[model samples]
Target: MTWEVRFSGFGGQGIVRCALITGKALSMYDNKFATMTQSFGPEARGGACASQLVISESRVLYPYVTLPGVLVALSQDSYNTYEPKLRDGGVLIYEEDLVQPKEDTGRVQMYAAPVTRMAEEIGNRIFANLVTLGCFAAITKIVSAEAMKNALPGLVPDRFLAVNEKAFDRGYEYGLELLETRPLSIEEAP
Candidate 1:
């Protein structure tokens, strides 16, 4: 089976970095294979940014995520842009504080988590992407916690290592909480 995930937000939201870190962790530590690609705006903060991930247990030929199994949108613009492309029965996880999705897209399961608020509470609002990553990890178990721990040092710069680690851990735990409350089904996206 294969999993296609898309992460999108404004340029400085770390959407690309989150995709890369997840792909690398799955490839390096979890022993699962993955590929990642990204697109970003010219300006840093306000422009659109998107990253896609294709993951499988075996060798993956294609590198693009045409129909995402999971769509993580951290901003309203991103949500509005990618919502229609999500596969039926796919998952749409968004930041509750930043985005308000349409009434109900029955084809996709919707999850609204306050990742930005959680990150700010942790004293680093920039770690919202990491929080979202943790939520993804918990819901899917696509990458192991140990793998995430190992991937952190390489994914983040040395100066902000501690903060990044904390952010990752916070996300991981929050994801677990989400899982315990509402487990994600493994059914294929239609």
Candidate 2:
């Protein structure tokens, strides 16, 4: 299987870190081939930022996500920019707190999760990225929840280790719930 995932948002939203964690999880725990890349504007906050991933069963030859199979939009600006790039039938996961789906787009499957709310509920706003990652894991099954959990300590700072782990677990479970109700098919690209 091959997957190209794009995570985009404002600079301070942790798009880059999220991408890194994903790559690390794939490489270290899942034992899959993965590559990650990113682009960002000048400002640290409110600037456009995007992180891309390419994962495969064999050695990944490219590090860029040309036509993403999964797109994660963490802000309205991100939705506006990358939503058009998703391949037909691709999966899009967006932050419900910041974006309202464009009802007219029928080419892709979209899921909205309140990542910020989930993070806040877990008592740490910084874990929003982890929550979103969990959502991705749950929906895609690209990385197992066990692998993600095992990979966390290396990705997060020592001070935030515990809560971030909880946040990831919550997101993963939330994703799994969605999957149980609406499972995705694994057909080849048309």
Candidate 3:
């Protein structure tokens, strides 16, 4: 079965890095097949950016996402652009401070976390993506925590690993807490 996920935000927010880390974690450490595709505008910082990931137990023939089963939106623009593309009963994870989702369609499950503010508390806003990744992992349960941790060393700088690790832990814990309150998880794959 294939699971399509999209991570989206303005550029410089590490939208691409979120997909990269998730793809690496799932493919390299978790023994899953994952393919990623990305798109961005010309501006480096404010441009809209999106990364699509396909994860499966077997080989994935198509690399692009037509309708995402899970959508992680870190900005309002991303939410506006990708919300309509989400399949019915899809999961939506968003930054609480940045996104105000549409009226409840009664068809999708949603979770919001203050990842950027949490990252700022940890150190910098740059780690927001990792924080969001942690939320994604804990909420989705598609990729294991060990796999995600194992995939981080080579991805982040040696000096910043500790901070990033902290950011991940914080976000993960937040996700777990959210799950306890919301009690929502991805529906079993058909």
Candidate 4:
């Protein structure tokens, strides 16, 4: 099966890097194939940004996402912009501190976390992206935590590796706890 995922947020939030890391984890460490594409808005820093990744067990023919099955929205603007395009029965993940979903998510499944708040507990808010990635890994189980951790060394600066790993762990642990403590309303993975 193929999974199309979109990571969306304002610029300077490492939105594009999320796709890059996930693609690397799936393709290099998890033995899956992945293709990634990214977009940035015209505004300098706070503009909308998004990155798409297509992951499959086999080779990926297309480089762009046609119908995203997973949507990670780290900002209100991004959630509003991409939520409508999510495929039916898709999974939607968002930053609870930054985004708020509508009363209904249609047939889509929804999960939320305070990614930025979690990052602040570490060193800075910059690592929220990594935290979100970890949450995604646990919530989706598309890639193992070890694989995602393995793909991190080169992507993050050597000095900040430890902190980034901690951020990831925090999110992963939180997600695992969520799964274990709460019941999922959705039936299947999209």
Highest TM-score model number: 3
Model 2 scores a TM of: 0.94
Per-candidate TM equals 0.93, 0.94, 0.96, 0.93
| lDDT, candidate 2, at 55 | 90
lDDT of 4 by residue, 55-128 (tens): 98889887788889899999999999999999887888899988978987367878889999999998899999
Please give the distance, in angstroms, between residue 118's alpha carbon in candidate 1 and its true position after superposition.
0.9
The list of candidate 2 runs beyond 4 A from truth reads none
Instruction: Count steric clashes of candidate 3.
Output: 0
Per residue, candidate 1 scores C-alpha lDDT tens digits across 148-172 of 7678786788888788777778877
Clashing pairs in model 3, backbone N/Cα/C closer than 3 A: none
Clash pairs of candidate 1? Answer: none
Candidate 1 stretches greater than 4 Å from native: none
Please provide, for model 2 over 68-135, each residue's C-alpha lDDT reduced to its tens digit, 9 standing for 90 to 100: 88999999989999999988888899999998779946588778889999999999677899999999
The residue-by-residue lDDT of candidate 3 on 1-190, one tens digit each, is 7899999999999999999999999999999999999999788799999999999999998888887899999999999999899888888999999999888867788999999999999989999999999999999988998899888988999899889888888999999999998887557543
Between 2 and 3, whose lDDT is larger? 3
Q: Candidate 4 — which pairs collide?
A: none
lDDT of every predicted structure (CA atoms): 0.85, 0.86, 0.91, 0.89
CA lDDT, candidate 2, residue 71 = 94
